[model samples]
Target: MGDHQIVENAPTRAWVLHPDIRNFGGSGDERPRDPARALEEAVSLAHALPGLEVVGNEVVRLPKPHPGLLFGTGKIEELKARLEANKIELVLIDGPVSPVQQRNLEKAWGVKLLDRTGLILEIFSDRAATREGVLQVEMAALSYQRTRLVRAWTHLERQRGGLGFVGGPGETQIEADRRAIDEQLVRLRRQLAKVVKTRDLHRKARAKVPYPIVALVGYTNAGKSTLFNRLTGAEVMAKDMLFATLDPTMRRVKLPEGGPEVILSDTVGFISDLPTELVAAFRATLEEVLAANLIVHVRDISHPESEEQAADVRAILASLGVVEDTPQIEVWNKIDLLADPTARLNAAARSDDIVALSAITGQGMDDFLTEVSHRLTGLRTEEDMTLTFAQGKQRAWLHEQGVVESEEQIDEGFALTVKWTETQKRRFAAL
Candidate 1:
């Protein structure tokens, strides 16, 4: 994802720029995002990567972006002088940069260039702990690189282990590089399929267990891990950083007061402007959310852009085909960080659908738990289901759940009458 050449023990000096082109149609963001906040997020993304020390950052306001160089002559000269004065080695553009524009900018400014997608891919590659996660990141990076296979490999080859894809000479070299990337993608897909199959097996195993699955989802750094740890007492990496927990973690939690036992899943955080490649690559991992019986949407209510962040999360959820019928609870986490949390919480208390709490302090946790128990107590209905001769797993799962009241063997397979809650119905449908 990144190709910045750095000396040992020396962080790569990088400059961050967010091009605020006035007329530019916001890419995936349907509504306008605050430019200052957007740039702040960009800088945070830069900070998320380990080896880059950001020297300077700016919100470059423009009427429009230049297709050839992104910035105009005056702005280019201005930024170039700043880069040289600061001895910046890499320029991180906080938005999409066409390959031609990237090459021209690098040549003119005498610095290596990386865009938002590249930086994120680098961070994922660095932080991906699970084997599936690593494979997905590699596949996504390869796909991203396949399109931008035109940069000269002056120093990238020495830094990133012979990626050798970018900056090739001519049409022949570019075609060869693309073919190589395709081959790598094919290999990764096979590996990923096997991993996903294993994951699915685990999922089916969980379905047989007598516990409903609850998934926690929210924007990055929204305190999901903290809340999960509070509920389950698992030592997940909970830090004040974007993407502190990349891969999903699960724990079986026994509710207090003889409430229903459940499995709590903490998933990768959602972010605005997440690269499309990552969205597609991580879909398999995210299917857990779909299989969940309840979704707890944790939000950082103290942030000024909380509503916008929630909107982004919801948008992504909708894109993933999460139906509106799914049971959900909105959690306003980190109330301890709020100014006069009393009034803020009082306002939040107006809605039964929302719960405001401090995960670290354990405030309002009882109410949250009580609400979860209340939601999980869904009405059950009896229904008849039929299974084919080859569907032994499904038939066994239905019986294992203790929901089947009667079963009759038939020529096609078996017919059963079962009583179950909406959550169980959804889970069975998934199978």
Candidate 2:
């Protein structure tokens, strides 16, 4: 029955375990996250993958992780009994599990095991839609699989040699596996390079039209896609699920009250402890966020771990080398889901740098748009200049941009007052 269970139809019964390791020493800020919240996040991740029936979840407290087996022997036996009674087929560990630990745990429990990174990769594999997204996910999965090849093959100690004429020193099975993975990675990289080139051409074409970019970035399921749909009237898939929007989507949106039009970009949501393989593979896709003229960080204000999620997003942005001075706004989303009305009202009264809104309810959307317009307008520079009759090309360019607020013919030329952004000014200068 277990062997014949269909992943799409039968839905594997899964158990989630989050190890609350005491004195878990690591670099950086020392404050540890709440274990309960961490466990809740793991459960949510389990739900993110379709056809995974989360049968049970719990926090396994440990002074430290065991080297071979992640949990103590007694705890392992206890969980094994519980899994048998519940008929759980899969176990998901909410943190890193070494290959040795994973192999030992699966042997002891008589069930398949997956760690946080593995689960995330599976979710990405299921969610990726575009050709580039599929390629990137496959590359990342291959990279991750390469690391787990030790657990994958029992004949790693075997060796193979070439034909007599070409034979040198024989290669071990593990070396052959690693070489194959590396070759596949090279091929994928070549294909990805071509796709990226085409995407770059598209970006160049957009730059010619040259609307300022406003990118939405946030933790998974933080309502970024919802807000993007509200602003742009786009039909992008927005769900209360993690990683709902995998590939970045862009649409031209006119700001509130007939303000300037800007390109709104909805990017893949960030997560805490995102897989290193995925981060490297998706760098090309994330370049959109880096090029944005403005970044809107959406936060799920109703979630208990919102602050932690925001920190994760910021840390990732920093790793991506987002300029410190890049224009950004904090959007407190899902306010309608907040339990306290008074608190929600207070949140809505926050400063311009922060705006509270309910993307699902369309509340405070106008205010959010107003804030966006105000922020973008602040980046513009207005100046007056003189152009001679011979400078007809420049005059026409200014009119084309609709930045020529006022123009008057003078004795030897035309005096013009123009309002434009730095990018627009640079483009005109190039012209």
Cα RMSD (Å) per model? 4.6, 5.5
TM-score of each: 0.87, 0.84
Task: Kindly report which residue stretches of model 1 are placed more than 4 angstroms away from their true locations once superposed.
Answer: 1-6, 26-31, 152-168, 379-397, 400-419, 426-431
Tell me how candidate 2 scores on lDDT. 0.84
What is the per-residue lDDT of model 2 for residues 1-431, given as tens digits with 9 covering 90 to 100?
44344655788999999999887756535877788988988898999899899999999999889999989999999999999999999999999898889878877887889999899889988988878898999999888888877666522222222334233424476689899999999999899889888988777667655477899999988999889888878889888788888888989987868677899999888888777877887766578898788999999999888888999999999999998777899999988888775675676585658888899999878888888898888777789999999999998878766577789999989999988777678878898
| Model 2 segments more than 4 A misplaced | 1-8, 27-29, 155-171, 347-350, 382-419, 423-431
Clashes of 2: 0
Question: Residue 350 deviation, candidate 1, in Å?
Answer: 2.1
Q: Candidate 1: RMSD over Cα atoms? A: 4.6
Lowest summed-lDDT stretch of 10 residues in model 2? 154-163
| Candidate 1 TM-score, C-alpha based | 0.87
